[model samples]
Target chain A: MTKRQEHILQIVKDHGPITGEQIAERLHLTRATLRPDLSILTMSGYLDARPRVGYFYAGKQAGTVISERLHKMLVNDYKAVPIVVQENASVYDAIVTLFLEDVGTLYVVNQKGYLAGVVSRKDLLRASLGNKGLEGIPVSIIMTRMPNIVTCAPEESLFMAAKKLIDFQIDSLPVVRPAEEDSRQSELIGRVTKTTIARAFVELGSEPFL
Target chain B: MTKRQEHILQIVKDHGPITGEQIAERLHLTRATLRPDLSILTMSGYLDARPRVGYFYAGKQAGTVISERLHKMLVNDYKAVPIVVQENASVYDAIVTLFLEDVGTLYVVNQKGYLAGVVSRKDLLRASLGNKGLEGIPVSIIMTRMPNIVTCAPEESLFMAAKKLIDFQIDSLPVVRPAEEDSRQSELIGRVTKTTIARAFVELGSEPFL
Candidate 1:
């Protein structure tokens, strides 16, 4: 879509139930010239125009149209300090950390502060129920390894980060900086929880009314 | 803000790094007429204008400027089928339901399908660790009862529902239908989860790049 069309979508999203004449006036354009753009937006499902109420935003379609503001928001500003545990920590200790921190996932960091693995409450719960001793068992045995762990860059938008969480069905993501230009290792910086995106959405209030 | 001012904000938010001339052209207005609207939006913390890069969104303020789509989105369309259990059910049974459904919170319902209370994983965990017989203990003993439960109506906006969850620091909200105009009782129909809001935010993506 053209930049003008995207801008038009944002206008409808922010101030809807607006009339064509008003939209034209806001843009300083003739209603005749603005009509095509409005029609395109409506036909594309990004906007909806009422007979007398004017135009409003339609709900999302497959591969939703994300706004530029959200597309540019950096993860660093929104990420929370990650709750971490040593790789060798015992299951009992991890459970304590989980409750004390009130976090759904924990990052397992190596001695160098590089992300080693990840562990969830379900992992701890399952380990606790088995015959193995909670204090004796190291978290490494249950933690998901680095190769399988999902991580996000500090520069990525909340949109992409949130999509990763939804696509993978995970509750949180570790925000990291690449350790070297070519290395696979990364330095864990912060964490982005589902709550973070939810809070932002509440503040944004851009979704279509159902 | 005036409709014209809000529209100007949308323009800057979507096509930032765009010149004032470009904004004027898109809206079909003279740069002179658009100048005042731009100044007002920027001064109000809705838009940010750079000397070289044009304009951009200014992130959220105290009373977040919510989008019309979000203000219109009702809970009925987004709420999921509520995972519920009887208040009289055994604690052991409640745990089973929690795992089988894979939900963070459960709505405790009375005999008439009206919401009675709410139960969380922490509540069940604490109840199970004690000397009490899990099979004999009723959820009513541990669940948070009515009047204290946080809930939303199907007709309410997702914006309001999301605010409630954030304000209360809760993971989920039970969507209910009022039993009577004067009664406090409501029949639980669905649930709004953090995951749900997070996913919706990703789709919305109207927040500014911070």
Candidate 2:
């Protein structure tokens, strides 16, 4: 801002609800000279003006800013490293890997190292309920197979990933990129889970940002 | 915005890199009179000004806005109804309730209807791994007991609840209120889960808000 504008803002902030003529008097300028400044200030959300009340410092609106930042947050920057198991791995081994890695969902990869399926804790627990022992059963049999899995791209917005999680009523989404050898195959790179959204929400509310 | 201010904004947006003098001439206004408006517009992030070149519209910075809206969100507004089980209910019953309700966590309540413990999918999965049959064991034996469970108040900001979820590494928090008979006892009223955070994130990125 120019020195004069800064001086004008200070005056308004300190002695606000003050009239334009009064402000011009202090600055030794005509009200006409201050007209455009006052107009711009009010229009841009820096100050508020009223008929009888004159002008008052109208601070930034608290509920007015959210989507702009959310759109800029991409999945690549926030996705966590995916925990995966071989499609042939037993449900028992998949459960152990889930415990060892401390993740809610496990991506299943085929022998070709492309995404084959996804197994969540709910899926594992449901499988355990069966009379058949978990060790003998392959995760691929119980997992949500390829075409049914909800996946996201690294370039997608984190907001979109979060939306998919909510819409699908699932806990996580694999961040995948098309395989170089075959565009039809998906190679898992990372994951975006509800925990990721929660972490991002916490960061958005943290000190420097607040 | 005043009609004049809107007109000024449109001029800058359409004919940016046009000099202040050129703008003034087109609007049939004196350059000196337009100075304050230009200053205010630049300072408020509506326009970018270059020394020799002139002025250009500077669109809202996408990465600049987030925390304000997050702070406005309250747990009371976003919390989901708590899915709960009796403390003495068998672990097997709790698992059934979890699947029936499609929730990852369940609050365990005492006979008096006060919060006694909390159980998560992880907890149930671990219990299922034990040699002891889930049907024979009470959820109280496997749940995270009282005083150890992280909880939130209905009045707290959703952001704080989300922060607790991340900091404590928990899946969900029981939104509690003091029991009518005893202030020390917590009465479960609602829940805030990572799913809740994910849902809120999606809403923040939805249309109209954007």
Candidate 3:
């Protein structure tokens, strides 16, 4: 930590639960000089000042939370399970299947079963409304394709999964595993969800160390 | 919900905190017939039963977790804050800068302040060990560049951010806001990070709803 950062934190610790003006007054610095540091420190996870309020130390001391820990805790583990749909299945059949399956989204697969694209319930609804000739329409038309799929390996941690969810603004990740029978065959294994991450986080926060 | 699914959940709710066999018996189902459905339900976020014992409703049913909330969260409300290093700055200077700043990564920017690529602490560590001529090396050579930058709009919700993080498995999200003067001039405004999301989850779990 810089000498200035140390001073800033020390001031917060000693007279903390204190306001920014109070910090400036004690440190012999202007509020403007303190503002950038306060923003940086708070954003970096060192300071925990509420908006329009003064700063305070987020933890007993700073410098432990890493992007890696955040990734594991929030992502790699807590996602939804994925199911693939074959192209031969009719759109109506697919729709009924999904309703029976009760899933928000489904993956469209090629004959060899590689990921072609994804179909969300909304897409089906939109297609139905579009008069795109539902019976003649295939899911491939609306699906978001590969290089676009946000996927992960099963071995990665839950926090990694969470970071992707928050960073890219997606709902879930497809977990893929190489099929033993054929090296090129990748199977959709599981999904990590934001809700799962939230639940895990609750469990973790209640822990003493974490 | 399908009658089959309702039946399955009911059996678990009634006999469970009980075994899968009991659920099978109550539903007049073979253990084989119920296994796949049980697995699918558990994986899809509907049921949360433990293996070898029985299942329980383990997802947002206990509380409206982030995934449930994610359905309504948008993509434009967010801002991605990026960490940048000056062009002329040496690797040593950058290292000290990162350490003092308490940030895990930094983006190397050109003179115009447009993003170049990213440089992580790990990349610097690897650079340090090799005799790759550190002093004169501009931070640019090591960065992960433009097309590589996964960005989000100010309108995005924290859940959307979570999805990106999970999909890409990246550490930080550089939130961007459109420039007032030029529509093409998108600039860094805020950042959505793993720590930030973790803190949010912690905050969510602490709510009285749980």
Name the best candidate (by DockQ). 2
Candidate 1 — which residues are off by over 4 angstroms? A1-66, A129-133, A180-182, A206-210, B1-66, B130-133, B180-182, B206-210
CA deviation > 4 Å runs, candidate 3: A1-210, B1-66, B71-81
* Total residue pair clashes for candidate 1: 9
| Model 3 C-alpha lDDT versus the unseen true structure | 0.60
All candidates: DockQ: 0.25, 0.29, 0.02
Clashing pairs in 1: A27-B27, A28-B28, A28-B29, A29-B28, A207-B69, A207-B70, A209-B72, A209-B73, A210-B73
| The best candidate in terms of TM-score | 2
Can you tell me which runs of candidate 2 are displaced by over 4 Å?
A: A1-64, A130-132, A207-210, B1-65, B130-132, B207-210
Better of 1 and 2 by lDDT: 2
* Candidate 1 residue-wise lDDT at A13: 62
Worst 10 residues of 2 chain A by lDDT: A56-65
Model 1, range B1-210, lDDT digits (tens) per residue?
A: 777776776776565546789999998999999988888776655565556546655444322223655676788988999999998998778878988898778889998889999998767755654224678889999999998988998999888888998899888999988887436688788999888887777666633321
- Candidate 1 structure quality by residue, lDDT tens digits, A69-170: 567667888899999999999877887898888877899998777899999876765565423467888999999999799989898998899989888988
TM-score of chain B of each: 0.67, 0.71, 0.62
Error of 1 at B70 (Å): 1.5
- Cα lDDT of model 2 overall? 0.83
State the displacement of the C-alpha of residue B8, model 3, in Å, after optimal TM-score superposition. 11
Lowest lDDT 10-residue stretch of candidate 1 chain B: B57-66
Alpha carbon deviation, residue A48, candidate 2 (Å): 4.8
lDDT of each: 0.77, 0.83, 0.60
DockQ, computed on Cα atoms, for candidate 1: 0.25
Q: Which prediction has more favorable lDDT, 1 or 3?
A: 1
